[model samples]
Target: MSLETVLILISIGIAAGILSGLFGVGGGIIIVPSLLGVYAFTHFNSPYIVHIAIATSLFTIIFTSLSSAHKHFGHGNVEWKAALYIGLSSAVTVFLFSKIAILLPGEILKQTFSVVLIIVALKMLFDKKGKHEDPAEKKPEVFKPWLCLVIGALSGAIAAFSGLGGGVFVIPLMHYLMKVPFKKAVGTSSAAILITAAAGVISYFINSPAGANSIPYSFGMVDTLSAVPIIAASIPFARVGVYINRKTHHYLLTKLFAVFIIIVSLKLIFF
Candidate 1:
């Protein structure tokens, strides 16, 4: 690889890690568009370019989410029950839909990804701030199973299709509809992304071809050469993101996430 490519990948990793930790997202939002941007700049020609980008992004999320999750766990922000509930449901859909994703046209996937990003960005921008719960009011001890199933299916399907982690959907559901506290929602989303992304990775690998169709230094759809350096670069920064998140105000974090999402959406649409 060229020096320019190396620098780009490393920069993407650093940014992705910080975003993942701060927002409880899997960083796929940043990673996918960045990978696509690189390929576009290099004029890389491959029928599987989008597939490779998505697969590699999901693979990177495995490490990024784990690093973020560990920090969230330490702060006791993770809602273990909610994570487990959503994760189990989301994993099944991710595995099933990723197979379909592997066969879809690249243009179709890209368009779909753009649309999803737009929706997510708009939601973040307009979502109501969390209302303070009365101290005497009792919150439910458990999440509804039906709601979990619906969120998981939608999140997993969209996430698997775009190679973005399910945390994008999960965080919103937790924070907005479920009324989960911001920090706990982020922590739980990060934890659940581990499972959702893992399932998508497995499905992509299984459906990917070997031999001529596979890229050099790749395992199945995943580009190992790029993923390794990115993972390494991102891990340390994830801790930094978590620390910053703890110190940052919730309103600031929410606005930051919205802006970041909008920027990513525009890139995917116009790049």
Candidate 2:
């Protein structure tokens, strides 16, 4: 890869890591689109470019999520039981959906990703600010197993298809449906992303098409060469994002990000 490409990958990684930590997402929102842009800029055309980008994003998310989750756990934000239940359930669907994902055409995959981005952006744009509740007044976390299973299944499908690591859905579902606090939801979602992304990466690796090895710097569907620098940069920045998440409110920033996502989605859909 050229130095320019490597620099772009690093920058994408930094942004993705911070977003992953801040929002409990797997960072695919940034990673996948940015990778597609990188490929386009370099005139690297491939029928599996979308798959490569998604798979690589998932691979990087494994490390990013781990870093973010560990920090959140230290901050007492992670709900381990909830994360376990959701993550384990999601893994099943993630594996199953990945098998299907690999069969789809690159254009279809890109379009699907665009639609998912719009949905996530809308969720972010309309989401109400979470209020701080008194300890005594806060409801105990009481997520039902069945509901968690349902949420996990849905999230996993989204993760596998969109390479989002499921946190976009997981965070909102846990916060609204299970009544989890926003911070706790974000932390738990990060933990769950670790499982979902791992499942996705495994499936993408095993199910990769013939000649996948011919792709430069790739292992199966994953672009390992790209993933390495991204993961390395993301790990430390994930901790930085965690710190920011804890120290400040960013309602305006979230809204702006949502707008950015919408614009990106529009470009993907129309341009």
Candidate 3:
């Protein structure tokens, strides 16, 4: 890789790690686009560049989510039972759909990813239930196993298709449908992502296209060497993000991020 590309990946990692910790995502939101950007500038010629980007993002998420989840667990933010239920259920779909993802055209995949991001961004922007409410005033909702399973299944499909770690959907589902607190939802999503992304990366690794081994510093479709720098930077910063998540109200940050997602979606669609 060029020095310029390495520097950009490091920058992407820092941003991704913080966002993962703050929002319980797997950092794929930043990683995917940034990887695409890097490939564009570096003239990395390959028909499977999109697949490589997605696979690499999933691979990196394993560590990012691990770091973020550990910190959230330390803060008593994780709902372990819910996370396990959702994650285990999601793993099935993640594996199945990821295999399917490799068969689809790259343009189709990009379009699907963009649409999902727009929908998720809109939902985040308009949801006002927790904006001003005191956490102490709310009663925790009962955990429903069936609902979690459904949510997990849906999230896993999204993760496989978009490489977004399923957290974009998982967080909203748990928080809105299950009435989980925002912080707990984020924590739970991070834990769930660990499972979902693991399933995804495995599928991508084993299902890589023909001649994929010729790609430098890659294992199957995943660019492990590219992922190394991102993972290394993301781990420590994920803790920093978790600390920020705990220390302040995130209402404004959430709105800003929602806008950011919309912008990213548009870029994917038109660029």
List residue ranges in candidate 1 displaced over 4 A. Answer: 40-43, 106-142, 210-213, 264-271
What TM-score quantifies how close candidate 3 is to the native fold? 0.89
- Residue pairs of candidate 1 with colliding backbone atoms: none
Model 3, runs deviating above 4 Å: 106-124, 134-137, 253-257, 260-271
Model 1 RMSD in Å is: 3.1
lDDT of each: 0.79, 0.82, 0.83
Consecutive 10-residue window with the lowest summed lDDT within model 2:
129-138
Candidate with best lDDT: 3
lDDT of 1: 0.79
Query: Candidates sorted by TM-score, descending order?
Result: 3, 2, 1
Residue lDDT tens for model 2, 25-99: 889878988999998998888888888898899999999999999999999989888898899889999899888
Candidate 3: tens digits of C-alpha lDDT, residues 1-271: 8787788888888998998998888988789888888888987768878888988999999999999999999998899999998998889988888888888854676678679879888987986755776342287766999999988897788778778888777876776678787788889999999999998989888888797555687888898778988998999999998998887675665676578678767765776
Judging by lDDT, tell me the better candidate of 1 and 3. 3
* Poorest 10 consecutive residues by lDDT, candidate 1: 129-138
Best by TM-score: 3
Let me know the TM-score candidate 2 reaches against the reference structure: 0.86
Cα lDDT for residue 133, model 1? 37
